[model samples]
Target: MEFRCKKAGDECYGVKELTLLSEISQRLIQTKELKNDLSVILELLVRHLDAERSFLTIFNRQNSKIYIEAAYGYSSAQQARGKYDLGEGIIGRVIELARPIVVDKISESNLFLNRTQQELKSKDGKDLTFVCVPIIEESQVTGALGLLRLYNPYITKDENLYLLSVIGSLISRVVSSKQEQMEELEALRQKNQELQSKLDDGQRPVNIVGNSGKMRDVYSLVNMVAETNSTVLIRGESGIGKELIADAIHYSSKRARNNFVKVNCSALPDSLIESELFGHEKGAFTGADSRRKGRFELADGGTIFLDEIGDIPLSTQVKILRILQQREFERLGGTETIKVDVRIVAATNRNLEEAIEKGEFREDLFYRINVFPLYIPSLRERRDDIPLLVDHFIEKFNKRNGTSVKRITTSALNMLMIYSWPGNIRELENCIERACILTTDDVIHSYNLPPSLQTADSSNTQARGGLMYTVEQVEKQLIREALTSTKGNIAKAAELLSVTERMLGTRVKKYEIEAWRFKV
Candidate 1:
């Protein structure tokens, strides 16, 4: 280490402390015990630089506490405790603002709490300067370091601040790794909580099913978008599973525990859509007997799925745009602007661009939500998924109808494959529900096909011949093809199939396929 003195007024380098501080940094990587590692590093940096006192605080978000995990040079009484609140003093301010701050004059900085000023004075009144540095994790401020000093002629606050930043980086990696591990454990805990809840409820009410290329695209998009705050637009014809995709998006997000609200934009009358979306004060108008929170207000810190948005009235489009743009909105007949952190996931079968051109939709609103567009292909487009979807709907309806139907007849599945699903997945659902209601046997046979789906014998033969198998048979064939295409690589097969890895695994088990033999 070299030698020099820092001027009292200088806001810059303490040249004398540079070499020793650099050396302190080099030793940080070799230390293993996190607490000891940080303590040793900060202790060396402060001591070698002749600082009077130093401390490190680790943010505890769960309890809103910041424990003083490390400290040196303070009196035995002052350094005994290892904790403080988030904004209790200048130290907390560093974490709050995520910036470095220096208080050359104690009374002037205004960062001092009564206790903090008293504690600093106890350490040494000779040095009037102090510096605090923020520690960050995942681009977020997590904790801070506070350095105090006596009237040391050898060191300065600016040098200490720089050292703190460099040291904070090393400590942050350790803290962040611990934080991430804790988060993963917390996630597993939460997932277990949800599972326990699902178990308590008997069975989950919602389940997704599909194994097709189009569906695989939807699955891939869902996983990719789940990690972001992107606004998704799901476009598909009516009867398609737009709501299903919307649910998948929410359940896979960081805000999974929060509410996932769905609004049918078209189902509401232009007369009441405003009140329904943004809520209203008591007596906003007729039937507004009591004040209510709107969907946007209710879905704060969560996700809101707007369905059939293409059908919302033009006047209400303005309100939707404001909320999407500003992330804030006021209820009907209310003056207070309520801000919400809502992840907007909108779905509509109508062509929004065409609607915009016709003045039925707002161009700005469309662009705002079109950030991450997710257009769903119709059931007809993903016919390979028919059997999986059929199986899904069949199981659901069987439980609902209290029937024991376990299989879809091969010929019936083929018939389903050939029919152009004008109504999409929704139509298929209704068809399966009807089939379940009418079936007197274990198998959902071709004869159980609804009249809307049934056609003349020769055309039926041609249609069945067109697919060359029953709907059920085609479904099995598609599943087999998907598995083979991936060379029995179940995860890829699942992606090729459009179901979750779990769902694909289940099917693979049910079909007795040795999926493990395949290469990933």
Candidate 2:
């Protein structure tokens, strides 16, 4: 527990001591590589104090063990030998007691347990003086700093011990800071695993549609990550409903009651994107007449959906990256710092890795947002869910349009099933809505669908007889639509169809169509 230092009357000793302390403090503060910087600090200390060797030991409270973290003047084997339980050796005792320990001569002191098996004497054959000091933080010992030097008769026995204690205080700060970071990372890892396990016990997202194995996996991921504050990156092709997945995640989370703000990174012009995101004070820009809160601020205590995240400009990406890392930002024209407890749910259809290669995206930001990636499969990849989706959209549009369209005819449904939906679910929904409007009865027929859908390559029906029948069906449907659009005016209907009135009438008669029935 000794901590007293006798005043040295020699001016040279005082100057040397000040010089060592200044160098150690500067290096510890300036360098990001703390462990390597610490070794350098140890080397400085040993050279300044005229010591033979120096070492730092850290206590792992979880395991009740102490091991060397950094060292100077010790071989790899010697450093590897330095490990101890809480009260087993001198380093252990220094940490366990939260005190300094000094051995006048290693050979004569029974307490001097040389675990490293180094020679007891110096190169000059003088017994080495061993000194150990506890590295403490907030009144708790976390580690120890120790060094070996030949005994100096001119200096007091506890003189070097006091200097070691001061050095220990500096080491404690760096060691403790690193320990805190490690502890935080480990805690997050455990919490993530726990959340995954809880969701695996079978909670599904109620909002997202589809039961294909891929969609089910998406549902599981949404449920799993809903309870966590981790940032989520939803990757998929456009129209694959990434936004819907983002919606399910937000509404199912603890922040459901808070504002769930959404920002389309691609929709905003580059000139105004930063202002839209971080808000602006009045007079910040030419059009800024009043102060406005940004999407991040509005989503405080909730989640922000940054759709088309990859399309954000590189300049705005830096600010976004800062917000993701620090959860704080300053408004575009305001000096006041704003902090938000918002979870970010970013989505993009673009390949971010490719964007990174093209220098169009920030690599660090990519890693940050990609922590929990959820890839939504395209409609083609999960065609098994098409029937369910068709039914869902049918029921939805049915209620909206006050129509009793109960189902699609097999031929129409076959065409729908066969077409390559490059635009995914959104295209399917639009097709269903268009068909619902065209149908005059409960059943939607193939002729009522869009002409592009009836193409032989798309509908997979290319036989000569079948093609002729489909063409005729399409012609009849088109003439009926023209009549309806023209309100039974033959001339206007013919003009709309780009056909001569005589030919239109021939077709209408051939199909036995009642043109006047289309008049509302």
Candidate 1 has its poorest 10 consecutive residues by lDDT at 197-206
Q: Which residue ranges in model 1 land beyond 4 Å of their true spot? A: 1-206, 456-520
Q: What is the TM-score of candidate 2? A: 0.50
Top lDDT: which candidate number? 2
Q: Candidate 2 regions off by >4 Å?
A: 1-203, 456-520
Q: Count the backbone clashes (under 3 Å) in each candidate.
A: 12, 0
lDDT of each: 0.72, 0.82
lDDT of 1: 0.72
lDDT of 2 at 45: 84
lDDT of 1 at 53: 71
lDDT of 1 at 292: 99
